[model samples]
Target chain A: MAMQERALRTRKSLIHAAAAVFAEEGYVPSSLGTISKRAGVSNGALHFHFENKRALAQAVEDEAADAVRGLVRRADRTGASALQALVDTTCGLVDSLLDDIVVRAGFQLSAERALGPEARLLRTWHEWVEQALLGAEAEGQLAPGVSPDDTAAAIVAVTVGLEVLAGVDPQWLAERRIAGFWELLLPGIATEQVLASALPEAHEGRRSEAEEA
Target chain B: MAMQERALRTRKSLIHAAAAVFAEEGYVPSSLGTISKRAGVSNGALHFHFENKRALAQAVEDEAADAVRGLVRRADRTGASALQALVDTTCGLVDSLLDDIVVRAGFQLSAERALGPEARLLRTWHEWVEQALLGAEAEGQLAPGVSPDDTAAAIVAVTVGLEVLAGVDPQWLAERRIAGFWELLLPGIATEQVLASALPEAHEGRRSEAEEA
Candidate 1:
């Protein structure tokens, strides 16, 4: 058991190191030597853990996929409205894309190649989101004409898009900017009444909480 | 004047060739030798026009920026209502992003680094769109309570995001998918009346056009 734990920890350390290097220098330029050096592991140890750089990259992507799925699952468990859950979960993702290097690398790397595990993870997230949108529509949380499939895809696109832009322009990742993003997005998916009531309530709550703290 | 014209054509050829190479091989991996070879020019001739690879990249980015600006300017000159112009202009950008390799390269390169000229170009585009949004709002063409700056930024973010995703997933870039994107986006910016009339017309037009042609 102890040996397994040690292996897991070593594997995680390598992934973290690899994600950072990949995000900084990109896939091709980021070398295995640099990743190993950053992980504070010998080259032989790095090789023992992963077969190649592509494997290490896949591991990083897999870890990211799991983290994202875990977040959605936690949101699901909360029994919140589907729209609310999606907004909260998406906001969490945006925060990570702005602040978390590993998550950013996972997204960037996944796009550059056809990594199967990573692709499956992303597709699963999309499916989960599609299910959530269907629920939101059935609940009448969505607007009259909004298609569940399109809205789900748009929400995913907008969330991913905002993150991509944020990754490039840090200033645009501010809390206010994220709030603006939600404002633009939620209206499309939400009924007019929900937009008039729930969105303002959520925004105001965050503002007041920030002030009180 | 004749010599200047010859130089202009050579410079244009170099920019086109360089953009293709950069898109395929990326920045560091794409060498000056490859660019010159593609352009059918000698290394000395390539250097005569561009001081280095960075300079060549800047030239390519400049060409792309100009293309984007030109597209927007053409949209603005359409003599449509401010809101109509905004929507049409955005749609034009979406088309260019889908079809134009130079624009794609510019966007990719800009996100990867904080190049000065590239930053300026993007900022200029952003400001232009913001100004247009402000005008639309003042003219009562925009939906009530929509902040021009936020909406403008969201538009930029969404468009850039869609383009990036399309790069990764061509399957998602299908006409039907893009139409879905417009459906989600147009409602937020359009007035209720405009949404009722304009969106359906535009959507059907694009759909039939995509289908028949």
Candidate 2:
């Protein structure tokens, strides 16, 4: 049991180190030697845990995807309206991109052309946003002229934009920037009653409460 | 005069080839040799034109920026309302991304971590959007509660998102997709009297007219 626990810790450290390198250097230029050194693990240990650079990148991507899934799941569990849950998840996502290297690296790796299309964290997030909009549509939370598909596309684009911009400057993901996005978009997509409820600021207390729990 | 024209043509060909390679392989993996061969120019000729690979990439970025600047300028010349011009410019920009390899490559290079931060096409774009929004506010085209900064951020984010997503899938920059975005945003950001005129579709004829010119 002790050995297995230590192995798990080693794997986690290796993944974290890999993400940082990949995020900073991109997937093509990053070397496993540097990753293991950064992780403070032997090259043999790194090899034992992962087959090669691709596998290590895959692991990082998987972990990041899991974090995003968990973020979306948490927002879902808040029992807020679908649009509100989406707002919360998007806000959480930008926050994660700011604070979490793994998630940031996951997104960065997905953008690498050399890495091919194996990991599609952005598409996965887009699909989730689409489903949330669909749910909102079913709940009649959407405005009369709004189509779930169109709204989802716009939301996904903005969120992806923020993610990309945040790669260069975290200010792009600042609370004010995201809140401003919602402020501009919410009124166009939600009913007047649902509008106030779905505003990004409306979920601030809920986010903290959920965080505490 | 003939020698100068030939030299200019060689430079243009080299820049185009460089943009293609950089867009496909990214800035790090892209080779000057490949770019020159693709341009059908001897590497010596390429060297005579550009100091190094970085210079070549810089030239490509410069060409792309010029195209964008021209696009924005043409939109401005249309005598459209500020918001209308902004919408038209965005739609034109997306079209250019789809049709112009240099624009695509410029954006792709801007995203590369290996290339450093000397070239910031995205920042240039964000600034342009902000200025357009400020112009809209000045023209009384913005709806109540619409702050120029916030609207500009959202517009820039969505446009950047479309550009990034289009890198993977061109469909993300499709006409319907962009039109859908303006549809969702116009109602919220443009005043009621201005909304009808600033819509993306409303500018379609104007875009072709500008294109023909």
Candidate 3:
């Protein structure tokens, strides 16, 4: 059991290291040797944990997808309204993208074909968001005329886009810009009452919390 | 003058070759040899046209920025209404992303620190859109409560988001998906007539004839 735990830890370290290297140097240039070096593991350990560079990338992507899924699940459990939960989960995911190199690289990997696990994970995440939107629509919490699928897809696209933009230019990821995004997005999907009650307060709190953290 | 024209053609070929290589192999893994070979130019000619690989990347980014700027300018001139122009220009750019390797690479390059040119171009594009939105508002084409700057930023973000999504999955780039995006987007800023006009028309002729040649 102890050995298994240590192996898992080593695997996690390798994923984190690979994500950093992928984010910085990109997938093609980042090598297994550099990833292992960053993880402080021998080549043999890396191979034991991951069969190849592609497998290592898949591991990193899986870890990120799992983390994002956990976040959405938590928000779904806690949010006051279905719409609020969807919005909160999205905002939370965007916030996570700032701090989590794994999530960031997972997203970049999803854009490329080299990482299959991340791509599946991303598709699954979208399905989750789509389910949440449908639930909200069923509850009559969504604004009239909004298609849950389209809205959910747009929300995912916007969140990823914001992360990519933020990753490239931190200045644009400022409180004002993120706030601006929500301001536009919420009006399009949220019930007016929910927008009035939930969005403004949550957005404000999120801004200060992100700044402080 | 003939020699200058020959040099210009060589430069164009180098940029085209670099774009192809970058798209296929990504930034770091793509080498100058591959680019030169693809362009059917000697290494000396590649070096003559571009100082180095990074310089070639920059040139590709610059060419893409110019193309986008040209499209925006043309849309601005041809659009019958201010809001119409904004939407037309945006959709035009998104459509262009499907085929333009330079534009595609510009987006990929925007995620890296050493590739600031793409980020700068994106920012400039955002500013131009914002200005157009403000103009639309002044022309009384926007909704009363909408903030031009915020709305413009959101629209830009959505376009970028769609492009990124399409990059990963071409299905999202389909005409139907793009139309659905506009359906969601137009309601936020457009006057009623603009919304009506923004509805996607059925295919009437060769699609590229309406925009790209």
Candidate 4:
């Protein structure tokens, strides 16, 4: 392999190792040495890719942010209803949270004490939720009497709540559970017309671009 | 003060100190020595009521459980709508989690890695939600098609998630935020009759037993 290719591979390995360690041990207890050992890379190589653990954690957060952006973009492009897009985005989100170690570590590290101001991932996620729901409201997709702001609060709370619950029980991360939230919430928020034609079931996580396209 | 009164006072002080330390520093890192120092009690006094750190944590948990039971008991006896009782109980719960150090520590400790299966406090809280919502369903206070089980799940997630958010920003625990949650949800869950008369606002936290009575 080319020298650049090998270097990139080594960097990926270190991040994977760092994410697993952070997810399990949190920020204070985890060590660079353990992350290096897990990555099967030399300590020097780990240091070469990242200056310190905080930097490594930041990289994880950036990656998670990118992953979320991808999910939202997919939802935006779909000719699906604005409400279904929101639902699909959450489905994709829970899938990433369940399947993506970097995303998990991004969140876990963001909450750690050692990296005190790094919780921007949640803030960013919240911003996306607000914007998307507002857009949906303007398009007249919302039910009568439901304010976009209040609906935003409910959606953000439940999503964050599910994330916290997932920490204790993986069962909380199931797609059906996410579906249950929308199933309960949509009736109160969406118009009858939207419900009849555009309401999606609480199944299917984020669909890939090619398939949906 | 009488000797017995003074002794009881000292015990109360010690538990308060332990809860503050545990809430800030968590289970493993907080020292009994610091708790004693904070309590302004001698080491002997600290040892008299609680044998060790774990014991001290257990005491906090027990006290928190008692406090929750008190809230629910008052709600249950008021001859109010079962749905209102659930709302008020959560209002009271958020108030305690915000203002009561022991309650906050009890929840924090329940989620600690060192405690193993000692997360009974959360399970107990979940049970109460399930039963209360179920009772409301039986009384026909619930709107048509709103399942008690799914509603219970949303309530637990939002409560736990808000508690976690409160750790970072006290704003999350504001009475309005909690009220906002219920206001958004009550419409979907409560019957029209209940909505006309019993719809909860984002106005009050847990009311005192005297006030509610």
The C-alpha interface RMSD of every prediction is 7.5, 9.0, 9.4, 9.6
Output the worst ten-in-a-row residue range by lDDT, candidate 3 chain B: B202-211
Report the Cα RMSD per candidate: 5.1, 5.9, 6.4, 6.4
Taking the tens digit of each residue's C-alpha lDDT, what string does model 2 give over A59-172?
888898999999988998888888888888888988888889998888877755335754388778888999999898899888765778888888888887887777677788
lDDT (0-100) at residue A33 of candidate 1?
A: 97
Residue-level lDDT for B145 in candidate 3: 61
DockQ values per model: 0.36, 0.41, 0.30, 0.30
In model 2, what is the error at residue A134, expressed in angstroms? 0.5
Question: What would you estimate as the lDDT of candidate 3?
Answer: 0.73
Give the distance in Å from residue A183's predicted Cα in candidate 2 to where it truly belongs. Answer: 0.7
DockQ (model 3, Cα): 0.30
The candidate with the higher lDDT, 2 or 3, is 2
Interface RMSD of 3: 9.4
Off by over 4 Å in 4: A203-213, B1-4, B42-45, B199-213
In order of TM-score, best first, we have 2, 4, 1, 3
Model 3, span B84-171: residue lDDT tens: 6776777777777787878777756654534753467677778888888888888877755667876766676677777767756876
lDDT of 2 by residue, B109-179 (tens): 77563357643787788889999998989988887557798888888888878877776687888988888
Candidate 3 root-mean-square deviation in Å: 6.4
Q: What is candidate 4's lDDT per residue for A2-108, written digit by digit as tens?
A: 99999999988888888898877766668999999999989999989999988888888888889999999999898776677888898899889889988877766
Per-residue lDDT of model 3, residues A127-150, tens digit only: 888998888888877766667877
